[model samples]
Target: MTTQQTFARRVFLVAGIYGIAALLPQYFMEAQVGRDFPPPISHPEYFYGFIGVALAWQLAFLLIAGDVRRYRLFMLPAVVEKLTWGLATLALYAQGRLAVFVVGFGLIDLTLAAFFLYAFHSTRAERG
Candidate 1:
């Protein structure tokens, strides 16, 4: 693999692992999160749904990592995936509606989005 491919692999792999580690526990943390964050998550469907979708994206990241070239087209949606959550959290944080802790996680996603973009650019030559 070239340097770009290596970087893409690492980026996606780390993102996947990190996402799983961070999100998986939330399935069991509904109560704790409600206690800590307040407002008590009135809708279980939305909360669990978000986690489910986010977790799915993480798996997709791993799939892309397995074959960056073959999945090059996927990088675009991956970037959007990161941005959706990252931007939402950061925007909420800016409005003073979210906690710093949440913003921190959002920043991570934003940073990864940037790297994802770079990775996509780097792999352009690999596209067949």
Candidate 2:
């Protein structure tokens, strides 16, 4: 495969794997997450809401992976999604609002964000 195809496939695989793999654990650990989480549970809305939004974005990533050019516009929002969680995690971690687990999650999001950015730019360059 050419480098462009390779990169596209890599993004697709990474997103697909992460989208599918990551949620199962969260699903199993849903109750425990509330219990083990550092803060008191004020409302389940935010928790469930986050999960819903995250899953939706994961679906978007999977869609983008299917056709990088057609879904190119979505990458902008994808980056925003990644950055939202990533920056929040880091900021929260820095302020002692969140645990290391969240920080770790943030770092992974940031890493993925980097790959997504690269994929976006390179895809454009390759096509243009």
Candidate 3:
């Protein structure tokens, strides 16, 4: 594999691993998060649903990591996924609706989004 593809593979792999590590605990931390973040979760469904969908995307990231050339197309939505959460969180923080600490995760997502974009562009010569 070329250096670019290697970079993409590593990026996705790390993202997937990191996402799983971060999200999996939330399943059991609903109460703690509510206490720490304030305003107890009023809707359990939405909370778990978000975790489920996010967890699925993490799996998708791992899948893409397994085959960067073949799954290059998926990089697009992956970027979107990062951006949606990152931008929304940052926006909320800007509006004073979210804690400053949460901005760290948002920034991480945005950074990863940039890497994902670069990875996608870097593999343009690869066979789809």
Candidate 4:
């Protein structure tokens, strides 16, 4: 594989693994997370909805890994997904609503955002 392809593969791998790692714990420890929240979680809709969407994005990352060139355009949304959570979490932390430890997750998202942007730029459409 070309250097760009290799980088794309790595990006997808990191994103996919992080996504899984990030979401699975929430499934098993929902109560723990709720307790950790400065403001306890009351609505199940938003929490579960976030898990569902995050899981879907994990699948998207895997799909991109499967075909980086064909699915390249999808990376833009992926970037947005990462940044949205990252920035929001950071902003909450800034406002003193979120913990520093929780903000670590956002930092990971921001880190992934950079990789997503790189992969998105490196990807190219088929000439034919």
Predictions in order: lDDT: 0.95, 0.78, 0.97, 0.85
Best by lDDT: 3
Candidate 2 stretches greater than 4 Å from native? none
Per-residue lDDT of candidate 2, residues 15-103 (tens digit): 76786687656655657876798454577777667777888888888888877877877887888888998999989988988989778
Per-residue C-alpha lDDT of model 4 across residues 1-128, encoded as one tens digit per residue: 77887799788977898799879778666687767763566887888888989999999999998888878888899999999999999899999888899799899999999999988877663312
Clashing pairs in 4: none
What are the C-alpha RMSDs, in order, of all predicted structures? 0.7, 1.9, 0.7, 1.6
lDDT of 1 at 112: 97
Candidate with more favorable, higher lDDT: 1 or 2: 1
- In angstroms, the error of model 3 at 82 is 0.1
How well does each candidate superpose onto the true structure, as a TM-score? 0.98, 0.87, 0.98, 0.92
Model 1 CA lDDT for position 125: 84
Q: Compose the digit string of candidate 3's lDDT tens values, residues 1-128.
A: 89999999999999999999999999999999899998999999999999999999999999999999999999999999999999999899989999989999999999999999999999998775
User: What is the Å distance of residue 35 in model 1 from its true position?
Assistant: 0.4
- Model 4 worst lDDT run, 10 consecutive residues: 119-128
Native RMSD of candidate 3 (Å):
0.7
- Model 1, 85-111: lDDT tens per residue? 999998898899999999999999999
Better of 2 and 3 by lDDT: 3
